[model samples]
Target: MAKRNRKKNQAGFVFPAPLAVVLVVLAGFSLVYVCLKAKTEALGQEIKALESRSVQLRQDVVREQCEWASRLSPASMEQALKAHGLVMTWPGREQIVRMRADGTIDSSVIPEVRPPARYARVDRVVMND
Candidate 1:
């Protein structure tokens, strides 16, 4: 038995192992960079959308406050009462007694503003002669 002489291989020069590894690593880094860039852009869009939503919510709050204030106006309250068929007559000039600077309607009447229950209660005494 005898081994036959093979012809010289004609394959082109192959890249060295370390160069191939470096190229693969560079490609991987480029791919990671592209993925990170895309993620950042997506986050930016989300932030923009949230900011617009917050602005809309603030505007809605302001609109609601304005509506509440208008509804609470004296004219609006009177209009609502009239719509409900309720007639309230103002007091006659003779019936309306002006309060004194000392918060007394008369010797027997003393007006007081009470604090909420969470505070300590204090009894007020007014001496009348």
Candidate 2:
């Protein structure tokens, strides 16, 4: 009876250690799959957000171009200049200066006809009491 029991136990019986190892391997694979799925979903959400932001940026660019177009019209420019109280006039022949290809003034211009300085000296009056 003892010999028969030993033969039955050793014949085609599954061991707990191999079964546990297989279960652990399957669990590890499942964990890795879940992690990859989560990462893919995160990347998809980021792509969607960036696409929306790009669309908004394109709309903003269109709006700015339209605004600039209106601002750049001749009438609009004239209005702006008038608002700033500036007077535009044609320069006289003596006031006009020509430039050469080398960036020097043309020899035909008189040396005595120098353009007005950007900032002139202001004379101050002093009162001695």
User: RMSD of model 1, in Å?
Assistant: 13.1
TM-score of each: 0.60, 0.56
> Relative to the true structure, how large is the alpha-carbon lDDT of every model?
0.81, 0.84
lDDT accuracy of residue 115 in candidate 2: 63
Best by lDDT: 2
Candidate 1 lDDT over residue span 47-81, tens digit each: 99999999999999999999999999999999999
TM-score of 2: 0.56
User: What are the RMSDs of all candidates, in order?
Assistant: 13.1, 7.2
RMSD of 2: 7.2
lDDT of 2 at 127: 82
lDDT of 2 by residue, 37-105 (tens): 999999999999999999999999999999999999988998999998765667767777788899988
